[model samples]
Target: MVFFGDSMLETLGRVVVFLLVVLVVLLASLLSLFFVMLRTKRILFPNFVLFIVSLLYEILCRLLSFFRVDPTLIDRVSVEMRNALNYTEFAATDPRERILLLPQCIRSIDCPARLDSLEGICCVECRGCAIGELSARSREIGIRMYISPGGTFTERILTRSKPKAVVGVSCYPNLYEGLLKAKLMGVPAQGVPLSAAGCVKTTVDCEEVMNKCKIRS
Candidate 1:
């Protein structure tokens, strides 16, 4: 059975080589991520780094799920990664150049808000939910805001508004999607994920959004 023994050894060698290559690639990516964090104004590279890390974390999430652990660790890592960026760079930007994107799911499912075509959500401050309250505050701060249900609609808003920075609120996956798209457009972006995620009645932290806006009295 020497032939069988030699074949097994050969298979083990290939597996070892494959694993070494994967380890080397992951180490390089980690080093690149570290350097990007050290001086993030190396703007373009940070976006690419974020994309790569996102893919890595997505794989980790799948592995975690296979073990029946919390799969949301992927989203958590992604949120932290996005938050680690320098938000203050856009602090002094004009309000017109900034947009706050609110998912329509943030509204009460039975709420009477309507789409205004150009404007995102037509709100009457019914006090049914945080939508009216946030709209009022965003107006006071002079930052444009939209409450969009997903579709070509949000993309249309992006095209028309052409924001240089965005404060978006949605579930983690949707938030991540927006970040990647904003990166492609060379827009600085951040987000607050919903406290709960679903097709209906998701909620966000209004206080956190205000903090992001750095709103004035």
Candidate 2:
């Protein structure tokens, strides 16, 4: 009985040590990649970095917070990584088969867009905000635009529109999750971060977004 108990304890200890070593390795790898990317404004081993980010996302963010670093830093890195990795495929996709998704918070406070079951928000081009002008340009280029009311509506719009590629504009955290979700759905995507992020009256870089929208092979 004693021998059996000792063997079990030893096995458990070994397993625990192995897991701790793996955790440290993953964290170290992510930190290295993060700093390198930040300094160069470029991604290195994007696929490997992306896998580590996805695996350690929550723990990495928590660790950053504990160390007084911005938690959103990881999200920003992940979004940029995805954008660089997906750029080729995304640019190759036809504009007619692409969708430009905007968050509703970027709209004017008194904007009068209404929600639809299939298309999230119906933009009337009331010239209430940049969406009107963007809408006109997107129409001219034969691309579809959807103003998502919230995060959940993104999947719905993608499913109904069946876009080959997507250019999504949102805050870093949302862009991170949105890009990951689109990747899982086998859709290439580019993310444009908001210049000013908030729940209400957020602002995006309209020129940057339009530039992304017009990327071609």
Scored by lDDT, the top model is: 2
Clash count list over all predictions: 0, 0
lDDT tens digits, residues 1-217, model 1?
2555878999999999998799668746654555464466333354565666665766655656877867664454465566556365556566667888898887887799877878868877787888788889989888888888677666788888888677888888777777767766767777788887898877778999877766221
lDDT of each: 0.73, 0.91
- List pairs with backbone clashes in candidate 2: none
TM-score per prediction, in order, is 0.75, 0.95
Clashing pairs in 1: none
Report residue 172 deviation for candidate 1 (angstroms): 1.1
Candidate 2 lDDT (Cα, 0 to 1)? 0.91
**CA displacement after TM-score superposition, residue 108 of candidate 2 (Å):** 1.4
**How far is 202's C-alpha from truth in model 2 (Å)?**
0.4
> Candidate 1 — which residues are off by over 4 angstroms?
1-49, 215-217
Encode model 2's per-residue lDDT on 1-217: one tens digit a residue.
3566878999999999999999999898889889888998877898988898898889999999999999999999889889999999998998888999999988898999888877889999998887898899999989899999885799988887899999999999999999999999999999999999999888887889889999998
